[model samples]
Target: MDYYKVNSKNLSLLKERVSVPTYDRTNVKAGILHIGIGGFHRAHEAFYTDELLNKNSNSNWGICGVALLSFDQRIYQTLKDQNGLYTLIVKELDGTLTKTIIGSIVDYLFAPENPIAVIERIANPEIKIITLTITEGGYNYNEATGEFEIENPSIQKDLKNPNDPKTVFGYLTQGLKLRKENNVSGCTIQSCDNIQGNGHVTKKMLLSYVKHAEPELVSWIESHVSFPNSMVDRITPATVSADMAALKETSGIEDAWPVVCEPFKQWVIEDDFIAGRPAWEKVGAQFVEDVVPYEKMKLSLLNAGHSVLGILGTLIGYSTIDEVVNDTVVSAFLEAYMEQEVIPTLGDLEGVDLNEYKKSLLQRFGNIYIKDQVDRICSESSAKIPKFMLPTVQSQLKDGGSIELAAFVIASWAIYSLGVDENGTKIPIKDAVKAVLHEKAVAAKSNPKAFLDIESIFGSLADSESFVEVFTKSYQNIMQFGVKKCLIDLNSKF
Candidate 1:
């Protein structure tokens, strides 16, 4: 099979199989500057922006993507090679593929190649919104202290020499400083990551960086800029070699960096853009006055559900989300956790039917076509649990809701972090605090308090006698009965 390479020239040829951009690519201008051009960004925000461009006469909302670190050089090169054009393969629940050529990305700048271009792009008066999908840990926030870590080596280096910046905070400081100097209007700095109150978090972290670097710019940023909180949801798995081959087989187009995601995607943003914005609502993006409830609901249900399944699934030798979700015991456990444990924490989410959402979440997670990897969900659980699951645990602790399921989830994570499953197979752990987690998990075998003692993740939960009691019992149960037996027992209780 001769597969045509994906580029601007081959869009016409590729359009025979996949939906190509209807908007004039030449006329598309970059109004939005996005950092971290990862799979989730492409599948969610960029997908919505593409729809907006297709429907609206306004073509100024085209995205200009940025790749910050040296490791991101491959994606930078791929996007640049394809002229910022790539294929998005949507895996529908009914075993259908919806392929589209996404051209919303008008430009891509690799920060490592030329940092000046990135700074200048941010300074461009036309660039209104500077969005980010730099993950939860990328914010340079110290979870334990609830403060930005100024002494991070990259931040320190960038602070010492702001001209050649390395960190996002440094780049943002220099760019916003230039914008101020250039008399460019302020724009919205939106975060598309899954953090609760992301906009407020971003504003605080950025201000913390700028205050230490350039105190003069602090007032300008506060008065000129607006940071809008957002709740973004999509199950976008990392693209593998098999996806490329699949694209070649189905669409007959060879894409260097194509993204694959489930059909369902959602973005709820606070309607607080300082500069002019696009009518993304036309393409199904909800603009709300307050995104907190939605964020709470999503993080507590979908995100935490992934963690729960991923930890237990990996422990039970299941490799993908669909595989684990297909198991009746695992599925029932998840349903109980969402209904009994998580839902109570999320007080009223306006215009949302919680039961329907929970049912849809199971369907999304169980989409066999999507093949969302368990390891991907299991990765960085140290960062994910605190943000996604533990909040529910905390809320449940305060309200006297059942924390049993959440406790089991935490215990599963601690056991999984030990780098070995029940069958003695080495479970490859990927976390920033892998060594610490392993050491603590090892220490926790005798003293369960050792694991809870990690003040950053567990916080004050270790002090709660009820939580500690349940958590210790859960940990011991998992060690004795294994994942499947324990899950069956837990589900039977529900």
Candidate 2:
């Protein structure tokens, strides 16, 4: 077995498997049209589809990936290079690693290069479910108001011609309009982003676009489309030269595009597709009537847990989640934050064991092999904080419980927004509020109210006495004593 020939090796492995899965490549048809072709999608959704295809020979769940942004051309070329084949390396905490080739993505289309072709494919009746992982920011909606930003150039163009626009909502609207015109059965639009009530968020953005662009079409879409909420989890890290080298060494396959993720993966989706869906349950996916509790549990706890480590981890100069989890101080902070702050705030969801979930989350975080980056998790904190952390903070405040850790997290954001870590190293702050955050931080150096004025980031919560006191106090503490001293103080106080 000449492993240097990685593609051949993969093909041979695929052939040797007893259940040589085969799809009606001709009649299979595109049942899933996915937006934002990224590493997470490859590790998560594409993996699920591969499993389904393996179980059922006649399954028609082939995916046609549409990359909306121009920079994604590199990814497009990489996937195309390998005939849409790639390996998902799932690294376990206990030094165990497993790799599998995902083959669900049947084709790729760059929207900018061929918008009409992409639109026509989505318009096709064959695409039963239009799934998205376009990131929370991709929707281009104002988080505080939950309304589409009409001022956005993309939104403006999308409004002018719903049939042809650059944005995802525009593409979806245009596709749906074509579907309605062609009398094609309406498809389910599933959002796989980490936003709370993500499906609703996506629906709102799409509907908002339709409202201004085509009012009658909005009604038709409202009646037809099913945007099922989903809670997706996986600690996938960005691929770098190290990852590529590791893949080449292990498999003797020089994969230009390989995805590295933790062994733990989860997909809890609402079973609400119109033209039917795969028995994903067979492939370790959970299909439930209400994904709310599951989503809340995952988002507020697991996802939020990751964010907690993300900010603190970066401040501590740790590169990965595993490093953060292994640090005694970081680990203690997370455990206390989860048990005392996060869990107490969460209302009981039927059939969910909060204790068990928290334990599992800790275990997952401790997985060293995952090598999940703090920076990656910390990206888009402005959007992520509201979904993952603020809800818990809000609930805890309402219940009269102390929110010391939550306050610390918020303060950490304020500190991070200053664009430098404790060591005076430049901390690359990645958020929509990046530009204005520095100015706010400077002004707030004299008065905390200046920081609170960023309504988009803080929402109405910043005005509240409870949040204001804690956030301001913590920010002051960080300024006076620094991150480590503040952490020590928080450990003592809370």
Q: Give me the candidate number with maximum lDDT.
A: 1
Which residue pairs clash in candidate 2? none
TM-scores for all predictions: 0.98, 0.95
Model 1 scores what on Cα lDDT?
A: 0.91
- After superposition, candidate 1 runs with Cα above 4 Å error: none
Compared with the true structure, what per-residue lDDT tens digits does model 2 show for residues 414-454?
77777777777788788876888888877878876677778
Worst 10 residues of 2 by lDDT: 17-26
Per-model C-alpha RMSD: 1.1, 2.2
| Candidate 2 Cα misplacement greater than 4 A, ranges | 1-10, 13-28, 161-164
Q: Write the per-residue lDDT of candidate 1 for residues 1-494, one digit (tens) a residue.
A: 56899899988888888899998989999999999999999999999999889885589899999999999999999999999999999988898888999999999999988999999999999899999999888998776667898888899999998888989999999999999999989988999998999999999999999999999999999999999999999899989999999889876899988999998889999999999899999999999999999999999999999998899999999889999999999999999999999998887777899999999999999999888888899888878989999888888888988999999989888889888877788998888888889999999899877898888777788999999999999999989888899989989999
